[model samples]
Target: MLTLHPNSNQDVVDQSLPVNFQDFIKSEFHDMKQDLTSISKDITSLRQELQDIRIAMGFINDEHNKINEKIAKMESKFKAFDALVTTVEHLRTVNEKLEADCNAKDQWARRSNIEICGIPEKKGENLLRITEEIAKKAGFDLKMTEIDFVTRVSSTNKVNKPKPIVVRLQSRYRKDDFLACLRKLKVICQDLGFAKNESRIYFNDHLTKFNKMLLQRAKVLAKERTYKYVWVRNCTIMVRQNDTSPVIHIANVDDLKKIK
Candidate 1:
């Protein structure tokens, strides 16, 4: 119902609506599409992170299982080691006990005072018996006696008492026979520190040296008035290896004997 000019009517119509409405709608759509795309990307990232977390968890679980298995094995090995240690301790204790028992037995044997022969008759009978036993063990038998005499002085201070005769047994038999006896006696006497040169005296030269040394010591010891000089004589002779031989005096104490 309105009459208007054509240009003014167009201008009025344009002014009635918003400007660039289609472009605004297109821009809004573009922004919304971009937002949706970003959201999708975020969701994909979140999913990948979750997957990584799950994989990591699986790996951690596998590692934990392996660790547990290793711990179990270690515990088993420790127990085995402990058992082995216990066994070794037990063995050591047993060995120590056995050794102690053996030592006790050996000590008892060494300390036992069991006599090998009958009671002795003379003052030096025990010494003779001991010597005899030692000799027998070493495959020899010889008589041993003390030499020299003791002379007591009289109360008057004028004359000394007559010294009693003292005799010492010298090996009267052949050097081989006496040498064997001497060697055996030396071995038995070695432990007691009675003499040191017994083992080294083998030949005639060694025996002569040993005898000279012995005589020197003996002379020094005979300074007592009661004892002047030691007289040694070989009393009896019997083959040690053959017990069936008759016992006889082979020589005197000073190696002077008839080898009949």
Candidate 2:
């Protein structure tokens, strides 16, 4: 039995105890089963989401690998192209050097040779006899035995365009003496009863095709740049700015800048 005061603040309450132990255990077990069911559903959903994430990661990794492969191939191709370009450049440089050396050797072969131009050609004309005649006329006192080789050079058979005579002297002394006699050609023409300017004979060192082009180019540059003289000496193209200017030996076309 209980007694309550009139001003006491109280609420309804259940003061009961478990009277059936087996029934309570069954109820508790049922609640736990429900909770476990919900947890199982959540765990299944989590596994699905993890699978999706794994698939996405695999796709990204595959794409990354493909991109890397492409980049590697491009790098390989670039290296090959670079190597090819380097080889071509090297071959071109070597070829140019060989050509320059060949031209130099060819010029050296013609070092002791001289050429006579403006001399008219005739049938059965003896070149050695004519050389002696010209030398004697120029007061050179030259002999026929001083000549090593003599020939007329003509690329075409046109008789009006007479070819020059090429002469290889037996000695450098004769070569110098031959050139000196050529300088006095005006005297030779006087002795031969020809006009001063009518001799029409010119003497020069025999030059290779390359050196000839070099001389031609140097002459053009000298004229265009107003140089005083452009001449060939010992198969070399020479340029001078004035009478007393230092002689510039033109070894190649690049040397044209000296006159320019």
Q: TM-score per candidate, in order?
A: 0.38, 0.65
Candidate 1's residue-wise lDDT over 1-260, tens digit each?
A: 12235766221222334567645655666798789899999999999999999999999999999999999999999999999999999999898778657644543332211111111123323344444455455565444442111111122112332211111234323323644454443332344233452322111212122233444444344443223334222212222112453333222123312112
* Residue range with the least summed lDDT across 10 consecutive positions in model 2: 9-18
lDDT tens digits, residue span 167-201, model 2: 88888767877786676675433343444635567
* Candidates in order: C-alpha RMSD to true structure: 25.0, 11.0
Q: lDDT of each model, Cα atoms only?
A: 0.42, 0.77
Model 2 spans with C-alpha error above 4 angstroms: 1-75, 154-160, 187-199
Candidate 1 ranges with C-alpha deviation above 4 Å = 1-17, 20-25, 112-260
lDDT of 2: 0.77
RMSD over all Cα atoms, model 1: 25.0
Query: Cα deviation in Å at residue 206, candidate 1?
Result: 28
* Model 1 / residue 4 / CA error / Å: 36
- Per TM-score, the best of the predicted structures is 2
